[model samples]
Target: MKDNIIDARGRACPEPVLLTKKGVEASPNGVKVLVDNVTARENIKRFAKNSGYEVKVEENGEGILLTLSR
Candidate 1:
């Protein structure tokens, strides 16, 4: 299935991860989370892993893109 994208740049700590988690949970397929910080990227990855979703990450310029799939 296709995925959705969420731009979470400039957001702090749990906000980025929490928002990403919510997006993934609400999606019918999966979500792609975009963040500008390493912490946000790691946190989102951990959240996906903990929630049992497949995750992939890519670094684009100064941002991180996280793909979450079931």
Candidate 2:
């Protein structure tokens, strides 16, 4: 299982979710998404969850970290 990281900070709306989807499609094992705002964080989490992946979120000074695993 490989871990893929998608940095989506400062990006708006669907961009973050899109990157997350791409990362997940590329690496089904795990995906770490870095987002700057609450909206992006929630959106990515929801997308991952709805796609059958387990979501874990962590708060950081720069932004939020979403760890998605299958």
- Highest-scoring model, TM-score: 2
* Candidate 1 minimal-lDDT segment of 10 residues: 20-29
Off by over 4 Å in 2: none
TM-score of every candidate relative to the true structure: 0.88, 0.92
lDDT for each residue of candidate 1 in 1-70, tens digit (9 for 90 to 100): 5657889999999899878878977894689998998888888888888888898899988588988888
Instruction: List the global CA lDDT of all models.
Output: 0.86, 0.89
Tens digits of per-residue lDDT, candidate 2, 1-70, equal 5557789999999999998888888887878999999999889888988999998899989689999988
Count of clashing pairs, candidate 2: 0
Q: Where does candidate 1 clash, by residue pair?
A: none
lDDT, residue 30, model 1: 82
